[model samples]
Target: MKRFSFIALAKLPIGLQWAVLAGGGGLAGYALHQTGLPAALLLGPLAVAICMGVAGTRIRVPRLMFRSGQGIVGLMVAKSVTLGVLLALSEDWYLMLLVTAITLLISAGVGLGLACFSSIPADASAWGTAPGAASAMIAMAEENGSDGRLVACMQYVRVVCVVMLGAWISHLFVGAGDTHLPPIAAELPFTWIGLGMSLAIAFLGALSGNLLPAGALLTTVILGSALQLTGWLDITLNGTLVTLAYGVIGSYIGLRFDRATVKHVARLIPVIVAANVVLILLCSALAWPLSYLFGKDFLSVFLATSPGGLDAMAIIAVETGSDASFVVALQTLRLIGVVLTGSFCAHLIMKWNARVSR
Candidate 1:
């Protein structure tokens, strides 16, 4: 009966498909939130969407909506990255750079190991495991004649693992206590005009950010951070709007997991998953020493170093009451490092794999 019901649900009209996602995702999110899990809004929708996707539902969140979600998240991150955060980040610039460089090396080593031992192709392996800026990695992979689809698959798979494990880690280290949503009306202090301006900025940022990979989010972050720092604008997003953004972003990724991609990569799934887990574990291990080095909570530093989606990690950082500013700064720095050095790293990994196999 359950299987039959799901089959029927899969064949629903596009509108009904959307309705199911919204309702199911919301209920799931609420249930998880009640359980005090951080990032319930994101993880719940992601899980539901993935099921809908694997079951072959024709559900697609519009591109603009996805970008808007990113924009909203970008602004959220911007609000967190204040002047004190800047000074702190600057003080530890060398450490951050060192960590990023080490992360890239570890990612490359993982890719090389995969290429040499696994059934996955070398090009795919090389690009799939790039540690930060997934969009940039995918684009760069394709530009360099790597398999873009597989690269995307590998990137998102790692992202899913990172988020799930990061959540669990947060639960263990920080304790998931009191996850109920704050009252929307009292969530933030903003005048009507401030809210209007915030939305305008998000909309415009998403509209104008298509020129680069993850540009909408990055652009919004830059714009919002500048305006907020200059005291020219105040961000005023309520809980409802932010939750909607989270739902859209999570749904966007979930809807992309069509049956075709899954079946095509089924044979490679084990190794891919193993690789992601290894990368995550290694990163988490680094977080411990770094936490002590930086005098921050383990969760804050862990979230900063976790090779997850920036938006997802940011949400977790905020929910757990960690140092969100530190998380954002380090993540932004690592993303920049990854984009700048992806090609050279890919080449090096590929070459090492070739030599080892020979």
Candidate 2:
């Protein structure tokens, strides 16, 4: 008998290998969902995929599928955008600027410390430690000549930590949290027209690769938000679509892992996790003052300022019954801030590192 079931199946046809992944991921996702963990479906597939990758699974998710998944997630997040959210952003532009600047500086400082003290490169460190849409950060990192695979790993670790902490805080403070989320399909079983439009838009967004890093995602978000605000677009993303997206993303990242990558990053994981924890704590601390100043509940504000991606934070916010709009607005604001500043920050850090070495 093979030492591991995965090892025994290593020589199977790639199609069968993928079948194994799908079966394992589905079972794991269902189990985790039943446990009510935050980002359960995504995390469950991720857990299995990581194990498969570590076992030297030869299959890899196609880049197109991964990009499509990103596009879908972008649309999902765009569903949160509304006219009132835009007005709120405009009204509190200065406050938004202040918090965004503070968050970036703190994150950059942490990245710099990690780069100076660790084996990771300066650009990779900056992108890895950045607080923004995790996928966006990873894409930008790759575009800027950083080790994107490592950045993806870093971002995932931070996301898991942030989600767990946010969920715990939400459950602890608010007994029987109050969520006002309407059913995704309160009107019909499903909107085929809406779903088709969404897919068409997402496919169009994926074509934005030449214009932007993570273009598939950001473009879809921008286009979807605009159309949604105009009442001309109906995004009909359901659990199955969402699960497929998550699976694609999870598998893509997981397949990037291998023995060499694992060994290279093994020692770095601990410090990377610590840095993420520190950033989360800092963001939470900022959230407290912002909560009082804005006359909002701490959970809402805390979630608003969290370092996780908009998708994961969205899950936590809905679960905790936090003020969904406020969280989305701030999260959207921060994502823009991070995306805008990501390249400049990486360049600055690289320069500093070069100077230090000389």
Candidate 3:
């Protein structure tokens, strides 16, 4: 097989190169989807992009593409935010706070464990193991002068593991039968005006996110939820658009896992994997009591508490007839909490490391 070279790829127009990469990514995603893996669309494209990147293809996705992807995912999440879900959350506000705090502890503990066992820096491990938005964590790690590539690898690896494990648990333990809920966003009737308005909000949200922490995705999520909550707009994102968003986001993250990055984190791989498994199991155990207290099924509670990407967990929630709103709501709350406290927490980790070393 002829290997793709960066120099040869650079000779082509950037647009053409991107189009070719996108096509390849799509085909790879399709193949993976056929294999019945959870999050095949995302994992598939991501795997292919990583290989392409390692092979020296200089096809870089623009920042705008990822932001747009976030906007689309945010809009999809908004579909689950109904008045009933809001009321459920309001009634259980204290419990939500408690769960959020517990999740933070779990993340911090995992970060500390990784730092102690691996050669990665404490601050880097802290941000890397945070069960927050992958993009947000990576960006913060870079801003904090930590190794962004390593952080990205850790975050995404956890996501993939959490997703696959979540799916298995949903199927084996929860018995996620056929979805009973009506197709909220996926089946909604589409209108050009609605799409145009949604796009405008997404674009504005992306621009505003520049000034806010974890702003791009969270801002769009807030905007979309508010619009639906107030009955001011019915945001119906098309399936094709949502899939495109997933593909782009997956490709962007996947390309970061080039050969050099893999080599850099080689020794820490086993420790990272172990920590992820431990975190997932711990969170699931915590979910059991909460499930009884909340009068919800264990599966829904577990999905809500599981430390995975918001979009990935939400997808599992939808597919399994779990409480999509609850899952997304809890995940969103935790994401916000993580992003807000990420810096302070990282500082604490670094300080502790310094003191212990001394």
Candidate 4:
């Protein structure tokens, strides 16, 4: 029997190399899942990709792969958005809007402070800290003449921090230890037609997302929800597909963390981490009052208010048996709000930076 050789694989074409990396990442993610760590699939692939990236691996995940992953996650999230959830959200529209406004302000303030104090540009910092979809923000930052690479670093670092901290907090407060994982497709009542329709929606959503702001994931979620909420379709994705989505997303993000970025932001890492911690604490505090007003537990509100990846937060909500619908709704609302207003806010910060520099 011949032994497998990574060295030989590395000599292959970049596309094939990436495929191999993805397979290895999926296996690693599965192994990590066995350890009961929250978001293990995401964390494992992310860690592996980061290590490979830092080691100077030239394999790259295409933009399509990332967008598809976002679509899959978006569809998964949309499953939580029922008519009941919509009605509840309508009743608290004012409160949810207020919370979204406050969170945006906090993000803007942190970004401005970073721009004023650090060497990072104002536009990059603003979009990086906007609390919007990480991929969307990065793209917007680049389009607006900011350093997309640095913005990606800031956004993803905060994402990692928010996810890990949110998981720990949820575990501590909600005691998710006793809760079993949700059943996969085999146990669920799902049809091939439903799966086919869902895939069609995801593909069309990805194409439409090119025209919409933060479109890829948001579009998928909206389309999926529209179908499900209308009782026209019910789609249940299998555990394997969800895990694959996680692997692609995690690997895509992790591969962006190369040596040059790490070295460039060495001094700024501490400041960025500090800013993220302060933002989370401030948001958590603000969530307390809303929890009472909404008749939800503190943990649920905190996760809802958290500036993290939407899919990761939603997953935590489901696993912890918290209000998944509420969490997903608020997160989705805030994400859209931020994406819509991000450009104007970034302009303001840039102007402010100019004035302060004078």
lDDT at position 133, candidate 4: 79
Clashes of each: 0, 0, 0, 0
Model 2: per-residue Cα lDDT over 290-358, one tens digit each: 987777789888988988656556655654556666776677777788888889988888888778778
Estimate, for each residue in 285-321, the C-alpha lDDT of model 3 and write its tens digit: 8888999889899988998999866776766676566
RMSD (Å) per prediction: 1.9, 3.5, 3.5, 3.5
Report model 3's TM-score to 2 decimal places.
0.84
The candidate that wins on lDDT is 1
RMSD over all Cα atoms, model 2: 3.5
- Ranking of all candidate structures by their TM-score, best first: 1, 4, 3, 2
Worst 10 residues of 4 by lDDT: 176-185
lDDT of 4 by residue, 1-358 (tens): 9886434554577876677677778788777566565566777788778777766678877767777777876777677777887788799888888899999999889889888988888888798888877878888888988887788889888888887788678666755344334423554587788778877877777677678654667788778888888898786677777777778878888888776787778778888888788777888788779998988888789889998687678666765667777887788888888888999999999999999999
Stretches of candidate 1 above 4 Å error? 1-5, 179-187
Ordered by lDDT, highest first, the candidates read: 1, 4, 3, 2
Write down the worst ten-residue block by lDDT for model 2: 176-185
lDDT of 3 at 310: 76
**Model 4 clash pairs?**
none
lDDT of 1 by residue, 50-97 (tens): 888888887788889988998887777777768888888789888988
Off by over 4 Å in 2: 5-9, 121-123, 133-152, 163-183, 187-189, 315-329, 347-358
Q: What is the TM-score of each candidate against the true structure?
A: 0.94, 0.82, 0.84, 0.87
Each model's lDDT:
0.83, 0.75, 0.76, 0.78
